[model samples]
Target: MNRRDELAANLADVRGRIDRACAAAGRDSAEVTLLAVTKTFPAADVALLADLGLTEFAENRDQEAGAKVAEFAALRPGAAVRWHMVGSLQRNKARSVVGWADQVDSVDSERLADALARASGEHPLDVLIQVSVDGDPKRGGHPLPDLPRLADHVARKGELVLRGVMTVAPLGMSPQQAFDALHGAVTRLRDDHPDANVISAGMSGDLEDAISCGSTCVRVGTALLGSRRLASP
Candidate 1:
């Protein structure tokens, strides 16, 4: 099959898997929001998928994502997608992100949270604290040890709504380990912020484990888009 055809098949397969996973976990299919990680993928694929009834798209970079969002809004306004900023967001880029994205999945620090809050103003953007379930300092998320203080900071910010938490598994660590640590982190966050219950974990490969551990959302990419390519709109 050609690329578009392959993309359609991939989307179907991933959706089927998600449905089955939720069933196995004794959860409703709607409970897990599938965010197509369109990071390395280009705009045409995004347009195609959006036309195919997939309305949630995610990207890590500001430039590419901003371009794609603009393109989709102009060309495929009917899509009405919920864009997710799924990467490390710099403090300076907060305004741009808050302007376009419906939700940001990687608010890792109090400073970033404050910046997003200020930039959001009346917007009250939805945010998730990126916890380092991977235990990698080089990565963007806060360490699990610092979650409460950071969550407290997020709660105090009126412009940024603290909806939940997100995490990425370490490159070498097992998926179960990542899920366990992430779920534990969620429990910790809920101790004080009981409403902070969303766990943004899992991906194309480790989604089953993520759901088993109580993930409310799974960011799926290649399994839904074939491989990915980084290109401008």
Candidate 2:
């Protein structure tokens, strides 16, 4: 089969998974947005995914994402894909990220929030607070206790909107346990900012568990795009 056919099959399977997961959780399937993580994949794949009806895509690194974003736009000028930053980001890259990303899903600190706000133009950049369910610094996320403060900062900060929370279930712990904690964090954040409702949890591996715990968005990469290509440009 051709690459496009393979991607179409993968997309359908992933959507089926989301539907079944949501049904089991007693939630509406429409509540979950399937965010295609196009990291390390070529812009051509992004264009194919876009043609296949994926409106949301995410990247882990700014350097790679920046070029792919430009290429994808050139390839499909009218495609309405929402690019998202889903990896640990440095403060210095904030300026460049705002140039491409529609939302940053890994804002973990007040300093990062400030950088993004200052770099963003007149329009407010939507953001999700990254929660460290396991308090692992290497992975980059704010501890549960810090969510409220960071949410407030992002909400009140210039040109930045606190959309919600995002997290990766730390290895060695059950994904369910990690998502349970994240659900609690999201609940508390919502109490303060009701509009902050986007819970970007889960990935290709454990999306079912995340959906059970209230993930409104799932970032699927390998399952959708197959294996990563060796080179990215």
Candidate 3:
């Protein structure tokens, strides 16, 4: 099949999965946003996906995403696409990231938040606190206990807007268990910042579990774009 045709089929199938999962969870499918992670994929695919009706796309690396964003804009000048940074971001990359990303879903430290805020300039940048379900720093998330302070830090930044929380299910725990813990964190996060309602959990593997446990966004990559191409040596 041609790439567009393949993407069309994959997009349909993934949306079907989201619908079924939402139905099973007794939630509206519209409540969940499908964020396609376009990392490692070429910008052409991004344009094709946009034609396929996807609006939000994410990338893991600033270098790849920076080029892709510019290429996509050239491909479709007026396309309404929202780019997101969903990977572990270094503070040094903050300035460049703000130039391209519409939102960032991996703010796990005050230092990172401070960097992003400083680079955000006049426009307030939207960010989600990454919570470590198991409190493992290696996995790139703020421990549950420290999230409130982090959230407060983000909230206090005039250039940053606290949007919500995001987390990957730690290897040791089931997606359901991790999402349950995330749901609790989101609940507490909302107490002080009611607008911080986004729960960006799940991917291709465990979106169903995330939906059941109240995930507002799912960052899907492989299932939508097929396996990623490895970098050339």
lDDT of 3: 0.93
Q: Determine the backbone clash count of candidate 1.
A: 0
**By lDDT: ranked, best first:** 3, 2, 1
lDDT of each: 0.86, 0.92, 0.93
For model 2, residues 1-233, the per-residue Cα lDDT tens digits are 99999999999999999999999999999999999998989999999999999999999999999999999989999887799999999999999999999999999999999999999989899999899988878877998777888888888986998889999999978999999999987887788899999999899999999999999999999999989884355
What is the overall TM-score of model 2 with all chains considered together?
0.98
Per-residue lDDT of 44-83 in model 1, one digit per residue for the tens? 8888888778887899998888888888777776677899
Model 3: colliding residue pairs: none
Q: All candidates: CA RMSD in angstroms?
A: 1.6, 0.9, 1.4
lDDT for position 62 in model 2: 95
Tell me the deviation in Å of residue 91 in model 1.
Answer: 0.8
Clashing pairs in 2: none
List candidate 3 segments past 4 Å from native.
230-233
Report the error of model 1 at residue 23, Å. 2.6
The alpha-carbon deviation from the true structure for residue 29 of candidate 3, after best TM-score superposition, in angstroms, is 0.3
Lowest lDDT sum, 10 consecutive residues, model 2, at: 224-233
TM-score of each: 0.93, 0.98, 0.98
